[model samples]
Target: MNTTKLNPPTQKNRLITMILAMFLGIFGIDRFYLGKWKSGIAKGLTLGGLGIWWFIDGALLLMDAFLHSLGKDSGFVKDARGQDLRLGLSMYRLKDGRLQRDWFSS
Candidate 1:
């Protein structure tokens, strides 16, 4: 029998996600920042459940950040800082020489 092992994806810039989740989760800013527009809108419509759901979400984001920081693949979205605006959502290098956006994979 032959078996193949699949590697998990890695997350980048988890610290920013955690911070956004903790401070602006009610507005779904964390989800939006993470590229989850649907979820972000839902969270925004709910007002984060008077802070309860937001707290939970923040905790989860923090946990995800911790795992990512430890070099563990958590399947979280990578936050790229500095990218060309013309690239529209795809990964691009900004004038400052920093990579931003994961870029739509073709």
Candidate 2:
């Protein structure tokens, strides 16, 4: 039996993905950037589900980015390879106690 594990592919950039989704999401360029070809084609064909899908996609990306910045998992956005995007400006934190911490400000 094989006993080796394969490393996943590199994660995609969140900023670029958000940019594409915000600007060209109607054509599914963001999905193509994430390597989701099938969905990309479908989105493009449907004009981003008559624009509803495009708006939802952009909103989800934004939410994910916000969550990531807070040191949380991205519940909405992920690449085709199932990797989280390199989003958010993770910052230095000051530990208030063993179970407490402050975000952004030191």
lDDT (C-alpha, whole model) for all candidates: 0.57, 0.78
Report residue 21 deviation for candidate 1 (angstroms).
Answer: 0.9
Tell me the tens digit of each residue's lDDT in model 1 across 1-106.
3332354234334555667777888988987876678778889999987787798877765655444333344333444332111122224423234444333423
Task: Find the 10 residues in a row with the least total lDDT in model 2.
Answer: 93-102
Q: Where does candidate 1 clash, by residue pair?
A: 90-103, 91-103
Best by lDDT: 2
**10 residues in a row with least lDDT, candidate 1:** 81-90
Could you tell me how far off, in angstroms, the CA of residue 28 lies in candidate 1 after the best superposition?
0.4
Off by over 4 Å in 1: 1-12, 75-106
Task: Give the clashing pairs for model 2.
Answer: none
Q: Candidate 1 versus the native: TM-score? A: 0.53
